[model samples]
Target: MMMTERGMVAPVAGGSVLAQFDDVLAAAAPELVGHVQAVKFDADTGRLGVVPDASAYGTKLRWCARKLVTAANAKVQGANVRTLHVLAPAAGKAGPATAAAALDRQPAAPAGPVRTRETVSDGYCRALAAHREAMPPRLADPAIVQAVERQNRALRELSRQAFPKPDAVEDTPARLQRRRQAAATEAAALRRARAEKAGRQVAASQRLEQTA
Candidate 1:
């Protein structure tokens, strides 16, 4: 017999039962200690009511119910916690059900104009164009370069879907040649700038060595 917090005789630990069970659970499963809100043990039927902080934790507790029962019975003498009942989280706590109810209470979203393939294609094309414009000409970091390449590939795929082969017009030979020449000119300018910067660095290092 155990004495209750109210000075009444009980078959098992009454108010103190909660603290004892908390310790047992913490020792048995440390991860679940923080999730458990409260513990109630019914000595008559040997049913243990475990109130969790959330519904997710309740599910988790249920998964390891057998292990908990075994651990509890072994740790607490005469505990005989046979059945584990995972009670709902305390009132006022927002759970999945509560969130769903709140969503149901909200007004339905206003209807908009129906979109067609042309509209979607136009949107994708605009987005791809904007992203391409925003992308740097060259990325120094390998990681940044890889990331930019991935984005470019995704955008290009979207653009291809937007402008299928049958509908797209090919660029003229003259225009293609001009684009190639422009790209070559840009590459040459970049190389020249890099070379100049390297030469300056080397000259500065030589000057430092002479002074030393």
Candidate 2:
């Protein structure tokens, strides 16, 4: 395979075919663009190798493999890319001798500070809370909200594990109701704040119009 002008790898025989396939793939799955490292096609085997930038992207590519293969075949006429094979990152050329020499030349990396259970729990909870707060208000989708709640619960569990309190009482019906009430109150306050901001912006615009 040879690198095209756009840095994508394509087979020598049908570089243009693969290039068109790449464009089609990008259009079909825009999210997979940067994540895809390269696309290689084998005419004899009728296999298209998709190299992802990371392992996580590889899983995504695999999930959408069938759709991609269909798209590729449609885009590249007579270029039958039947199977999609997600390839791992190419191994480095460094042998044992090379690695040993490099190790001898470079200084050892400093050890990172140890993270205690308390610290881990505190940091995780704080991060999760911040993430929840940072999410856009428009993203009120049930799935997204549930995902965030799951993360919040997981972080709370971790915190409990770090600092187990024997005297801690289980969440009763009244306690759950109170918690829900508090959350509703917080949500109302946030909506009021947003509405006030919008009102102020509108007032400012009207004043500007009057001056003009």
Candidate 3:
């Protein structure tokens, strides 16, 4: 097989050609694999055929064939991929049967976000749910009131401790005034710079006229 700086130009063949090509393709453009439904490489002819999942992706593969070839050649020992051929699968048959079959198979529902009992938030929620059960309706009114007040006090303390009062934020009016002042200062500086530049240019022109 012929090789160049750009990449392999000759035909490639071997027992592990398919596996090697997939690995190279994945390494070169990981996103391209998802767009491609299947791959068929003719080592004898130096042609690489790709069955794209969609028409747009088929066009995309053609556009980026050069970079793809170069990358694959760099990874594979004797990869000779001269041309990239985008194959259009026949009706109801797109690429490999395995891929279509896999798509038809329903995947198990993915596990959701896990909440551990050990977390403070989880414990707090659990405590709230069980609080009424702990204090049955038969409990004395005074005892219930005392329990509620104690809970409120604890929550208030926790709120204070968990989130300490931030330094007083500058009110909107003051913030706006500061921004306006800064903008005015910047505008003045810009105007001064422009004036200085104009003065320098005028001085240079005058010097040139005198020299003439």
Candidate 4:
């Protein structure tokens, strides 16, 4: 036990404050009794520091720290416990930190096998062939395969979104053909609309010229 400047005998190693806090918690909030440990009282600032048994309790204890101080100070006179500071056990420790550092240093697992263009095309072709066979089954079958494989290569080269492989939707022949046809139709419609708009503007200018 040590005597403070206020002429009060302070608890040695926080015995008085810890005892007071334990009694207060036990009477009021019994469930939170063991959540906090290592109680310390600051005579100067009226601040209280507590080390939680585990980090999980730190958040819970912090939320009600002020209430805990009031309860504790009321229970034990002369402690003057005010603001509560919850100290996590692992905050300044090295064991858990070293383990985390080692984990970060460990090499990552190798990625799954990348599907090459030929491999992907063969897989798709095999899946397609399972449904129906193409003419000559060898020569004619390669047309869709080559088209999709070429597109996959081009797409993979263009953007990171196409990384590892192109979208499976682009690999399907009927879907690819439909997408191309839709794009062509939209482009043609846009061209016709622009031409019609330009003709209307020209007609309006000619009418103004005639009026002038």
Q: Which residue pairs of candidate 2 clash?
A: none
Over 86-174, each residue of candidate 3 has an lDDT whose tens digit, in order, gives: 66533333445644443434244448956666556867788998997798577568988999999999999998888877674445988
Q: For model 4, what is the error of residue 140's alpha carbon versus the real structure, in angstroms, after optimal superposition?
A: 48
Model 3 / residue 139 / CA error / Å = 99
Instruction: Tell me the tens digit of each residue's lDDT in model 4 across 106-182.
Output: 34654897666556566777888777754454456778999999999988778765454554335678878998999
Tens-digit lDDT string for candidate 1 (1-212) = 33443445434443445557667778677787756744456766777766776777778889988988888777766566788877756445534454344434435654896676556676888999999999989749998889999999999999988878964767899979999999999999999999999999999999999999
lDDT of each: 0.71, 0.69, 0.66, 0.66
* TM-score of every candidate: 0.37, 0.35, 0.35, 0.37
Error of 4 at 61 (Å): 0.4
10 residues in a row with least lDDT, candidate 4: 90-99
- Root-mean-square deviation of each candidate, in angstroms? 26.2, 32.2, 22.7, 21.3
Model 2 earns a TM-score of 0.35
* Quality of model 3 by C-alpha lDDT: 0.66
TM-score of 3: 0.35
Tell me the lDDT of candidate 2: 0.69
* Model 2: lDDT of residue 148: 99
> What clash count goes with each model?
0, 0, 0, 0
Q: Cα lDDT for residue 135, model 2? A: 92
